[model samples]
Target: MKTDSQLQQDVMAELRWEPAVHATQIGVEVEDGVVTLAGEVSSHVEKWNAERAAQRVNGIRGLAVELEVKLGALDKRTDVDIAQSARNILSWTGSLPEDAVKVLVEQGWLTLSGEVEWQFQREDAAESLRSLPGLTGVSNQIGIKPSPSATVVKAEIEATLRRSAAADAKAIGVEVHGTSVTLTGAVHSWAERDSATRSAWGSPGVRKVIDKMSLVY
Candidate 1:
């Protein structure tokens, strides 16, 4: 097992390796296995990429991002313009339903609220708005509309996990209560853990997925 300092170095190196990130401007700190990213970037996309780069590193049990988006003068768009751009992008997104997402902008921060039939739709909406110029942050308040029938949530989730080819599918426990799922197990890497969580969320009628799984390495 790598020590906390070793893990911290690995994460810093990973950040530097990512082309989208300005690694020198970002500060990385590790305690135990948790990573905290602190600094300011020129764009929201850079901040998001930095977080993803850190999460890709092994031994990262948790991540707390304190990075801020410090937009330049040319990148600064009015709140009205940001809202229009957000709406336009959501409209152009083929996966999302028209008029399903409601946008509210305040001081360059955007908040999206609405209900979608699936989790992917909710995610897609936020992703479409993440790279918008002049945006300081995004809050995805969109929720999933529960299916009328949840009789087979547990079975379906298990089947999906198995189909995903997760390394420890059998070891992962799936517990369903109402439309919520709680996953418990130990995986060898972050990829397996994310796969298991996505499988749970993909299952129909799953409004919430609580990932209690941990990394064995």
Candidate 2:
């Protein structure tokens, strides 16, 4: 069995390689298989990233997560604040109906799950969650499909891409079901692909953008 320090070091190593964690700080203390993370991060997303990073490394009794959040931004949130804000955002957003959605917070990270009407609701849910205090990241594992007009949804997605992407929204094919948009085809680079997705996400009614775009290596 690895010593606490050894396991902690391994966990840190894992976080260093993770693709998601940025714009924050992390500290660790280990005793036996128990791991505790300390320090202040900019967003709940980063905090969640740090914790998930620790879990992905393995060899731990449990996570004793002690993380502080930077105030003002939509990331740092207390448990009560997230619970209230979640209720508020979902109530206003009209994407996910009430009672169907749920939000859970641990150390400021907001975990969301439920059924929603539009794909954009899923994305909006993430955005709403991302803005709450102490929200490190949102686990948007929501399902879509309320069986509305698919054509109108696709047109809305295209219009949204036109407003946000600004480069080649016409070329970008959008398949929308409720609020979800699946973008298939090729783009110039990763940045462009992300930009396209951002456009879709920016739209008020859009929920999720499955960017299955390819780039030439």
Candidate 3:
């Protein structure tokens, strides 16, 4: 296991290596395995990139992001403009159905609410606006429409986990309650844990995923 100081250093180095994040404009602090990022970035994309870069560090167990977005004069846009642009972008995204997502922009923050059949579609709706100028943050409340039959959701998740190429697939346990799924197990790395969760979400009718899985490293 890496000490907190060592983990902090590795995270800092990762932030530097990531081209999207301005490492010098961000502060890193570690306690136990939790990393706290504080500072400011020029765009919402930079803040998101910094968070992703920190998560790529192996020993990081959690993140507390206090980074602020300071938009420049040219990057600033009215809430109405941002909302219109978001709507146009979502409409242009082939993966998302037209009018499937509702956008609300307030003080440069965008909140998305709607329903889709697949988890990937919900993700695609949010990813479509990550780099939009004048955006501060995004709250994706887009839901996955539950399957008609909940009885087979658990079984389908189990089959996928067993069939997936993930090395720890068999070690993970699946539990279903209505449209929600709970995954419990231990994996060798963050990658395996994420893969296991993704497999669970791939099932039909899984509106919420409770990941109880942990990293063994």
Candidate 4:
């Protein structure tokens, strides 16, 4: 006693696909929306794709992820192989020091650990890994340290920000305790807060910049 349209809507909601997508692949039946998918995709990842795609169809009371995982299409690389490939990309790019950063991939989730000479490099490492497929999230614990020539870097960051925020250099407190810079002060607007942080990074000697600026609205 189920309607065709009702079943279709259920599967679609489960996946949160676009309206246009629902309109296209909605295959309805008298009993339920029996979604039958066919294809030859690369790996087990795509095997899940078939199920997930059918799942988002709306009224899928039952699903058949019967699609075969075409191993021939895949390189037969283990998860560790993909993880090493991901690490190599980050290391070869010198996003962080080699061995200083560790990459671990499990079921497509990329985890990174390491120390870098700059906040930029730490961030770069995390970003590069995020681009890999099947990433759930990144645990970026990369520590940053000031370069030997960070004084110039700090000065440059400050100069660039001063163009926007009317920051009294004295009002902005800067404390360099290791590889991180603690910024304890206040800025007028959100824009000023961002500008101030950018200035801090421009300074070559700084590593990470933490701001304690509360918006005064």
Candidate 5:
């Protein structure tokens, strides 16, 4: 196990290594394995990248982001412009069904709400808008169209876990209730926990994934 100081240093170093993040503008603080990131970033993409860089470090139990996005003068745009850009991008995205997702913009924040057949489509809609200039934040309310029975969902998640190299299938427990899946167990690292959760979301009918898994570090 790494000490809190060592963990903080590693996270800072990882932030520096990520090209998309401005490491000097971010502050990393670790306490009992939980990392808190505080600072201001120029873009929402930079803020997102900073968080991902911190999560890549080992021995992290939890993460709290206090970073704020402060758009530069050149990056700022009107809400109408932002909304038009979001619509154009969503329409051009081949992974999403035509007109399946609706977009709303308020004060530079974009909100997407609709239904999609797969979780990846829902994620792709939001991810494609992250780098948009003048965008402050995104609210991804796109829901999954439920399919498959509970038994099949559970079995597919278990099979995915077993096949994933990052996760230990035996160490995790899966429970399915309708379209919702609950994961309960202990994972050795954040990567394993993320892998297991992603597997649960990949199931055909899964709508919500409740992660009750703890990181052992």
Candidate 6:
């Protein structure tokens, strides 16, 4: 286990190492393995990058982001412009179905809502718009259309975990309730936890994934 001060230092160092993030603009505070990030960032992408960089550090039990996005003069745009840009970008994205996702913008924040057949498509829709100028944040309300039985979804996720090198299949437990899958167990690292969740999302008809797995350092 790492002391709170050590964890904070490590997170700050990791933020500096990430090229996309402006390390100086962000403040990292750690208390009992929980990290709180507070400060201001120029763009939504930079803010997202900073969060990921902090998560890369070991011994983080939880994270709370208080960072605010303040767009520069050159990056600022009206809500209409942001919405149009979001629509155009989504249209050009080959992975997403045409008009499958609806975009609404308010005060530079973009919200996407609709239904897609696969989890990847839902994710791709939101990712495609993260780089839009003047965007403060994104709310991905897109849902997945369920198609498989709960038993089959559970089986597929278990098989995927077993096949993945990053995750320990035997140590993880999978449970399915309707279209939602719950993962409970202990993972060796953040990478393993991500792998386990990804495996669950890969199964067809999985609308939601609940991660109850703990990271064991």
Q: Please, what is the TM-score per model?
A: 0.96, 0.46, 0.96, 0.50, 0.97, 0.98
Q: Could you tell me how far off, in angstroms, the CA of residue 149 lies in candidate 6 after the best superposition?
A: 0.4
- Residues 1-217, candidate 1, lDDT per residue (tens digit)? 8878998899899999999999999998888888999999999889999988998998888899999899999999999999999999999999998899999999999999988888888889999899899999999989888754555888888888878875577889998888788999889888899899888888755788898887898
Q: Can you write out model 2's per-residue Cα lDDT over 1-217, one digit (the tens) per residue?
A: 5678888788888878877765237788888677888988776666777777887654566578788666565434478877888888778876666777787777665678887655566767777666565565567787654443668667665776677643467667777766677887766544566678776665445556687765432
| lDDT, each prediction | 0.89, 0.68, 0.90, 0.56, 0.92, 0.92
- Over 4 Å off, model 3: none
Q: Write the per-residue lDDT of candidate 6 for residues 1-217, one digit (tens) a residue.
A: 8999999999999999999998999999988899999999999999999989988887899999999999889989999999988999999999988889999999999999999999999889988888888999999999999758988898899999999999999999999999999999899887888899999999877999999998898
TM-score of 2: 0.46
Q: Write the per-residue lDDT of candidate 4 for residues 17-65, one digit (tens) a residue.
A: 5322322333323244454544444444444544555554423344554
Which predicted model would earn the best lDDT? 5
Winner on lDDT between 5 and 6 is: 5
Worst lDDT run of 10 residues, candidate 2, spans 68-77
Q: How accurate is candidate 3 locally (lDDT)?
A: 0.90
Which residue pairs in model 1 clash with each other? none
What C-alpha lDDT, on a 0 to 100 scale, does residue 84 get in candidate 1? 97
Once superposed on the true structure, which residue ranges of model 5 sit more than 4 Å away at CA? none
TM value for model 3? 0.96
What does the lDDT come to for candidate 4?
0.56
- Residues 1-217 of candidate 3: C-alpha lDDT, one tens digit per residue: 9999999999999999999989999999999899999999999999999998998889778899999999999999999999999999999999998899999999999999989998888889999999999999999999998674656887888888888786466788888888889999888776777788888778866799998888778
Better of 1 and 6 by TM-score: 6
Give the candidate order by descending TM-score.
Answer: 6, 5, 1, 3, 4, 2
